[model samples]
Target: MNEVQARQAIVDAGTVLYKQGYVVSNDGNISVRISPDTIVVTPTGVSKGDMNPDMMVVMNLDGNVISKGLRGPSSEVKMHLRVYRENPDVTAVVHAHPIYATSFAIAGVPLDKPILSEAMLQVGVVPVAHYAKPGTTDVPDSIAPFVKDYAAVMLSNHGVLTWGSDLEQALARMEVVENYAKVTLVVNQIGSERGLSQDQVDGLAGIRQNMGLSPIVMPKGNAEVINGTDVIPQGN
Candidate 1:
C-alpha cells in the first residue's frame, strides 16, 4: 500500500482496538509495512480511538523516523522492527493489551492447547515470551525466538503481539487470541475440559497443510487434567 493507505489502515486499526477494549489510555501500537524499507506506525502518547491519519509516523526498516507529523513514533517501535527483520512475510504488526489475553500473559501462560480448531488453523501456538522491559531493546530480544515460527505471542506480564501478511490479518489474530483466552477461562470455570485427541489434532494439521496454512505442533502429551479440571500450562 501507499503511504496514505498505510496511515489510514493504522488509524482504522487503532479505532477497532480501542472500541473493542483491546487498548486503553494509549496502551497499544499499530504498524503497517508500506514497502520493504518503509513502515507507517502509530504515534506515541495519543489515544488510539482519537487518532487521525496524519498522526501516523513513517519510519525506515531500521526504526529511523522518516516522516512524521508533530508526534513521534511509538516507544515500542523496536519490537516492530525486530519482527520485520525476523520475518519477511510479515507486513503488519499489532500490539494490544486485550483483557483476557493479557490475563494469560500476566500469569505467564501459553495459549498452546488444541482446543479451538479455527484458532489452531489460523494462529497455531501462542507462546509466552519471557518478561522484558517494554519500549526497550529487551522487548525485541525476548520475542526473537518465537517471531519466526509463530503468528502471535503473549508478552509475559505485558500484553499480546501479533503479526500477519497484512494489517487486517494481524488484527484478526489479536482478536482470536483474546477470544481463545475467554473461551479457555469459561471452560476452566465449568470444570473438566477435554482437548482434541492427538489423532484429531494431526488430522487438523494435515488439513491446515493442505490449505497452505502453517501447522501448529502440539507437544506430545495428554491434555492437562487436574482433579477433573483442565489446566493450561504456563510457559517457561
Candidate 2:
C-alpha cells in the first residue's frame, strides 16, 4: 500500500475503534503491515479519537524503531511485532480492551464457548492465553499458537487480540468481538444465557467459511451464555 494509504488506515482505525466503544481513551493500539519487515503502528500515549496520521511509528518486525518523532513507539509494540513475525498472513493487528470481551479475560476464563452463531462464523471460539506480563515476550508467545487458526484470542488477565489480511478487515473482526461480547453480556444479565442450537451454530460456521471469513471451529455441545453480565465465575 502507498504511504498515504498505510498512514490513513491507522488513523482511521483509531477513530473507528474509539467511536464504536471498542476502545476508550487511548487504551488500544493498531498497526498495518507496510512491508515484509516493517509495520506502521500507532504511537504511545495518544488518544485514539484524535490520533493524526503523522504520529504513527514505523518499526521492523523485530520491534526495532525505524522512525520516531513527536510520538514514540507504543510500549506494547512487542505484542504487535511478534504477531507480524509469527503470522505471515496477517497484515494488520488490533489490541483493544472493550469491557464485554475483556470481562472474560479479567475473569480468567477462556472464551471457548460458541454461544453466538455469528461469533462462530466470524471469530469461532475465542481462546484464552495464559497470563503474561504486558509488553513482554509472555503475551506474544501466549497468542502464537492460535494465531494461525483463530483470528482473535483473549489475553489472559489482559485484553484481546484480533487481526486480519488488512486493517479494515482486522478492525471489523474486532467490532464483532465487541458487539458479541456486548450482546452476550446483556443476555447473561436477564437470567438467560442459553447459546444457539448445535445445528444453528454449525450453519453460521458454514456460512463464515464460505464467505472467506476466519475459519473458526464451532465448539460442539451446549454453551452457557453469559449475556453482557459477568460470564467469568466469581473470584476467577
Candidate 3:
C-alpha cells in the first residue's frame, strides 16, 4: 500500500480499537509496513479514536524517523519494529490493552486451552512473554522469542500484541484475542470448564494446518494440562 493508504489504515484501526473499548485514551498503538524499510505508525499521546491520517509518523525498520509529522511515533514502536524484523511475512501490528486479555497477562496466564475450536483454529494459543518495562528495548526483547511462531501474545503484566499479513488481519486477531479472554473468564466464573478432547483438539490442529496457520506452541510448558483438562487460571 502507498503511504497515504497505510496512514489511513492506522487511523481506521485506531478508531476500531477505541470504539470496541480495546483501548482507552492513548493506550494502544497501530502500525503498517509500507516497504521492507518503511513503516507508518500511530503517534504518541493522541486518542486513537480521534486520529487522522496526517497524525501518523513514518519510520524505518530501525525505528528512525523518516518523515517527521505533527507528532512522534508511538513510544512502543520498537516492539513493532522487532516483530517486522523477525517475521518478514508480517506486515502489520496491533497492540492493545483489552481488559480481559490484559488481566490474563497481569496474572501470568496463557490462553492455551483447546476449549474454543474456532479460536484454536484461527488464533492458536496466546502465550505470555515475561514482563518488561514498556516503551523500552526490554519490551522488544521480551516479545522476540514468540514473534516468528505465534500470531498473537500477551505481554506479562502489560497488554497484548497481534500481527498479520495486513492491517485487517492484525485487527481481527486482536478481536479474537480479546474474545478468547472474555470467554475464558466466563468459563472460570462458572467454576467448571471442559476442554476439547485430545482427539478433538488434534482435529482442529489439522484444520489449522490445512488453513496454512502456524501451530501453537507454548514456551517452557507455561500451559498446564491435567487429566485432559487445559487449565486456564482465574487470576487473583
On TM-score, the leading prediction is 1
Task: Give me the displacement of residue 211 in model 3, in angstroms.
Answer: 2.3
Candidate 1 vs candidate 2: the TM-score winner is 1
lDDT of 1 at 204: 73
Ranking by lDDT: 3, 1, 2
TM-score of each: 0.90, 0.86, 0.89
Worst 10 residues of 2 by lDDT: 221-230
Error of 3 at 52 (Å): 0.5
Misplaced by over 4 Å in model 2 are 221-236
lDDT tens readout by residue for model 3, 63-136: 78988766788789999999999999999999999999999999999998777767776688899999898777
Candidate 1 residue lDDT tens string, 135-197: 778999998888888889999888999998899999999999899899888888889667776
